[model samples]
Target chain A: MTEVVAREIIYCDICSFPPEYCEFGGTFKRCKDWLQANHLQLFEKLYSDDALAKATSTLSIEKEQQISRDLEKKQAKEEAKMERELQKKLASKIIIKRIERNRRKHVISISGLEVCNIDMKKLAKTFASKFATGASVTKNAEKKEEILVQGDVSDEAKEYIENLLQEKGLDEVKVEQIDDKKKKPKPTAP
Target chain B: MFKKFTKEDIHSRSNIKSSVQRGLKSKFLEQFPKLEPAIDNVIPKKSQVILIKCEDKISLYYVENEVVLFQHFDDLVPSLRTVHKYPDCFPKVQVDRGAIKFVMSGANVMCPGLTSAGAKLPEESLPKDSVVTIYAEGKENALAIGKLTMSTDDIKSINKGIGIELLHYLGDGLWKLVE
Candidate 1:
């Protein structure tokens, strides 16, 4: 039997669409810059003045300009939105709180991590395997999701969180570790 | 479908038995006979296939962490990633250049877009509710998958609203669902 040949399409790294269709992806300017950097020949073939003219030559000049104007506004708005999201990510915080279940036992609950760019459930699974304890994600009193690991490994968890934040380029993100103790009367020399 | 899909939409995932895999392969081949030649290369006999059940009864077939196909109800539709690899194996329709922006944004294809100057429809029109891959006027890669709202003849004659119902598109959650 003979093998059938398949087509190899070049997708733009920035927008994840074929380079020819990147103009419609809202991130057009960035996609163009990326294509120019990675594949010079294809970039010239798609974006050169002659090629651009041929692509929209069928449309009336006025209509073409109108569409382009709308696209430009969209691209600007998209760029601004992306910038805002990045700033938000950089400003977020993660708090690892050790809530005292009793005098001898502590439950490590990681809060304020909802803003982080990782999956809480998957992280809980990893923590369960890594710490050899029951690690699960559950909503706290305020209805925010937090990972609860059943053990007193607060220092280890803090170190792990620091390393994780560093790897994600969020070194400025403060992983605050706080210890909580319930109000209880001390046993009087029992 | 998949307009605002996120990881939260996934309910569960499990590996299917080889018998079920064979049944799916045969069903896919029956839908698109042109895919028979490259079926083995696409889905190897020994490879493990995982079925990820998502919200709204949508189930995705994943191989090597990449979603190759999906099923909504009973229609077995190939993903855009799969369309890019074997474009010739599917029935396709090209929309005009002007519609590229709207299609990329996950909008339904209008009849005017299908019958416009730059677009081309098949000589023998396909029936309604048939799944077809969507390509743009000047683009080499297929942008989305859609099901026909009416026959191609009806689209040409009517030249009105919503000719094709878009299922998935370029930068949607399904496209971005890389584990």
Candidate 2:
């Protein structure tokens, strides 16, 4: 059997701050060794022996780094969330439906306004299927156009149309004008 | 690395702060129409100012002192930002009938024609209706700025309501021309 001898460790007798310097000739290194030999009584009261050396009383560098990263990610997430919400809310108001009914033929017209600044062709294409029910828009060179219901448009239906237009920012607009003398919609060849 | 602040940046910031203050002041005046002295204090001297580029449109609010502020859509929070981004998309439909400037669809918002409402919000949301003074204009009649009732979406869907409860035509058409 071989006999093992442990090396003698030195501890500092100093202030609460980490011992960076020494008055004596020898230098002290490693907080764990310093705490164990010199301040064993204080160490026992402050923290458990296994954890005492690494535990810092003040803000640690690692903790600070984590806090900064978290703050940045939060800000970015908030900005992205706001952008997404804005797009959703804005997109909802762009389309409106107008309906007209006649005994034989019905005509519903949707017009493009200068202020609306929408892609008329794209909008026209989007609702082309719904517009199939006698709905069409005529883009006049000088004036704005509307979806004309060839037949009587119910109050509820007209209200819906007006709401869509208002959401799109077209103020000073009038809807649901009844043509007392109904005219047949221009016939389309299938 | 540090980037030096430019003269333009300082100028713009000052102008924006002052303009915001002015706008807030005007809003206060509108609320207290009877306070003559208070209103007069808020109005700045016309000659003592320089032109500020508000919302990219120029205005002579506080020029001589070089404290002009530009009011952009970004200055406003969520609701205003939503409308400013797409002014023409909602609340308006083109007139199929010939010879009209534009026709409003009372779908999302109600304008001019005061009546019943269809949206969830009540009439109190409408900015108090009043005639305001038109001070300036932007490109293609963009209505540089005006006090408005309800958010843009509110006006569009309300079947019976005054969408633009208070409109100050910023340019020529604000007041009737004396022929």
* lDDT to native, each model: 0.88, 0.34
Model 1: CAPRI class: medium
lDDT (C-alpha) at residue B137 in model 2: 11
Candidate 1 structure, TM-score to reference = 0.94
Q: What does candidate 2 score in Cα RMSD to the true structure?
A: 29.9
List DockQ for all candidates.
0.63, 0.01
lDDT of 1 at A168: 76
Q: For model 2 chain B, where is the 10-residue window of minimal lDDT? A: B97-106
Candidate with top lDDT is 1
Note each model's CA RMSD in angstroms: 2.6, 29.9
What's the lDDT of the predicted structure labeled candidate 1?
Answer: 0.88
Candidate 1 pairs with clashing backbones: none
Compare the candidates by DockQ and give the number of the best one.
1
